[model samples]
Target: MAYVLQSDQRGIRTLTLDRPEQRNALSDALVTEVDAALEGAGADPDVRAVQLTHTGTTFCAGADLRNPPDPHALVALMRRIVALDKPVVARVTGHVRAGGLGLLASCDISAGGPGSTFALTEARIGVAPAVISLPLLPRLDRAAAARYFLTGEKFGPEEAARIGLLTLAGEDVDTALAPVLDGLRRGSPQGLAESKRLVTATVLAAFDRDGDDLVERSARLFASADAREGMTAFLERRDAAWVW
Candidate 1:
């Protein structure tokens, strides 16, 4: 079964995450599919931009604990979104958590509806939001990042925009995204690519410099005794042992 559904209209390629039953979690297969779709959009001359959206109420529930992708592969995917010559925009109107925020941060622009809620949940699961911080820390408000990354508290779309996790938030995601999509469609191929580079340079630099270290850190954390207990507690619908 296809994990990603792809279509193109008016020079914009749309990639929809299709694992609704899984809350569109980032399984290895889904990550690979998304990466390959992005590659196709990047190479197609007629594709002026990419719009990444998803089906279901949870845009992504972070990594699939049962079948998480390699940390290196996840990092590479985030970097690819940042470095893709064409602009990438995320249209979200659902819950996003943990590593899913990393995906949102990597995009050039992201718009979410009022229904959207976000959280950096890794800390609650006995791991730091390490690899994701490559794209997240570069763009998020420092104080905001510290607060959410450590506390794992959920916030609304408005707060997500205020903290730089979302470019815009509105009552309707498509309404907010229409103008941005129009802008992309109007931009010349060279114009969009060059302009995107100017905005994403810092993010790409973070990926290049810290990517390897973060991947190792993430792998170590996931393998730790604490993470094992936390994940086990999560799967069992209970608080982790550390929670009082």
Candidate 2:
């Protein structure tokens, strides 16, 4: 099967990640497909909104560091999504972390199942939040994000909604997404597109203005031994002594 699958229903385009055995981790190929899928949905007049989802237990486990992704590539795609002229909603069902959190935050809306928890583990991996921070900022006020970003702590569904990272935390994402989708469907498609445009333009312009510095800073953190150790420890099923 393909790394990513794109399907459209009633003008809603859903891009699903197909790499489950690997915890739906983002490989370069998957990232490429993500970019392409977003590009196609953004351009399709019939697609009034884009829904991002995945198959399997782990919604996404971040980057497949064995082959690791170029942070810039995924970051750039996020800028595109934030700037796109349509609403993007994330339908999450399971564990989501790191770059996966970036994808979720980039979406204008997110609905998660009861089991969902969101975390940013870059610092734990000896890396900075980078692009994930960019999307996370506008929604989660700076202070809360800073604490979560630095600690690599996992927060649950209600906390996610309280933090503004998730719009709905229901027993199942489908129930929450249903009403939100209907609301969007009721609006003028042109108006919805334009509203998205205005929001994206504002956010993307700001991102462009300060994005480089942040990315560079994150790169420096990524080179740290702690980040490498933490990631390695997690993969090896051991505790990470961040104090060391």
Candidate 3:
């Protein structure tokens, strides 16, 4: 079954994460499909905008620990979204966690509903949000990043927006996103490409410089005994040994 679904309408390409059964977790296959779709959208001249949305109550439940994605591939996918010539907007109406927030931060704009909750939950699983930090660190306020990254606390849409993790939060996120999508559709392709470049230059540089190191760091953590026990505990619906 396809994990990601693709469709185009009125010059906008929409990529929907379709793995609702898994809460649209970023499994290795799903990550590959999403990256490929973004690349295809960038190359297609008829596509002016891209919408990254998901179907389900949970936007994404972070990585699929059983079949985790390669750290290098995940970082490359985030960079692809950041560097894509056309504007990418995320329509978030559900919960997001860990690497899912990386996907949101990589987008040009993200709008979420009040139902949307977010958390940097990697620490709870005995790993740092290393690969995701490439996009998230730049978008999030320093203090907010430190707090959430360390605590693994869940926050709502209002706090997400306040912390710069979301561009906007509203009662109806899709309705709130319409105007922004309309504005993007009106922008000339060249103008959008150059403007995005201007805004993302720093992120691109960070990706180039630190991407490999972060990938290695993530792999090391995932392979650790702590992560194994934490993930096992989570799957078994029990507390990890360290949890008191």
Candidate 4:
């Protein structure tokens, strides 16, 4: 089954996450599909904007824990999103967690419904949000990142917006996203490409400088005994042995 559905309308290309049964988890296959789609959109002259959304109630549940993705591939996917020349807008109407938060942060603009929730959940699995931190740390407020990264607490869209994780939060995410997409569609392709470069320069630089180390860190943690036990316990629907 296809993990991502792609369609183009006007000047916008929309890539809908289609793995609702998995809550749109970022499995290796899904990440590879998304990367290919983004690359295709970036290279298409007719595509002026990209809209990212999901089919399920949960936007993305992060990596599929049962078949955890390759950390290097995850890093490459995030880098592709950040480096895509066209403006990428995330229309979020569902929950985002762990690596999903990294996906959201990489977009140029992200609009989410008021009920949408978010969290950096890796800590609960005894692994840090290492690869994701490349994009997320730059986008999130330092203090907010510290709190959520440490606690793995769920928060609503308002706090997500306030902390710079989202560009807009409203009762209706698509409604809020329309004007932003329209604005993106109106810009000349060159103008939008250059402007996005100006905005994402720092993020790209961070990826260049630290992406390898972060990927290594993530791989090491996932290989650790604690992370394996925590992930296993999570899948088994029980507290990890270390949890007291």
Q: Which one is best on lDDT?
A: 1
lDDT of 2 by residue, 65-129 (tens): 88677778878878878988889988999999888888888889899998787788777666777
What TM-scores do the predictions have? 0.99, 0.92, 0.98, 0.98
How far residue 47's Cα lies from its native spot in candidate 2, in Å, is: 1.3
| Superposed model 1: Cα runs more than 4 Å off | none
Query: Over the stretch 66-157, how does candidate 4's per-residue lDDT look in tens digits?
Result: 67678888888888989998989999999999999998888899999976999898889899999999999888899999999999999999
Question: Stretches of candidate 2 above 4 Å error?
Answer: 241-244
- Whose lDDT is higher: candidate 2's or candidate 3's? 3
Instruction: Tell me the lDDT of candidate 1.
Output: 0.93
Per-model lDDT: 0.93, 0.83, 0.92, 0.91
Kindly give the stretch of ten consecutive residues in candidate 2 with the minimal lDDT sum: 123-132
lDDT of 1 by residue, 1-244 (tens): 8999999999989999999999999999999999999999999999999999999998999999999999999999999999999999999989999999999899999999988999998888899999999999988899998999999999999999998889999998898899999999999999998998988887788788999999999989999999999999988999999998
User: Of the pair 1 and 4, which is ahead by TM-score?
Assistant: 1
lDDT of 4 at 170: 96
Q: Model 4 compared with the native: what TM-score?
A: 0.98
Worst 10 residues of 1 by lDDT: 198-207
lDDT of 3 by residue, 119-173 (tens): 9988888899998999999999999999999999999999999999999999999
| Rank ordering of all candidates by lDDT, starting from the highest | 1, 3, 4, 2
Measured with C-alpha atoms, the lDDT of residue 124 in candidate 2 is: 68
lDDT of 3: 0.92
Which pairs clash (backbone N, Cα, C closer than 3 Å) in model 2? Answer: 125-227, 126-227
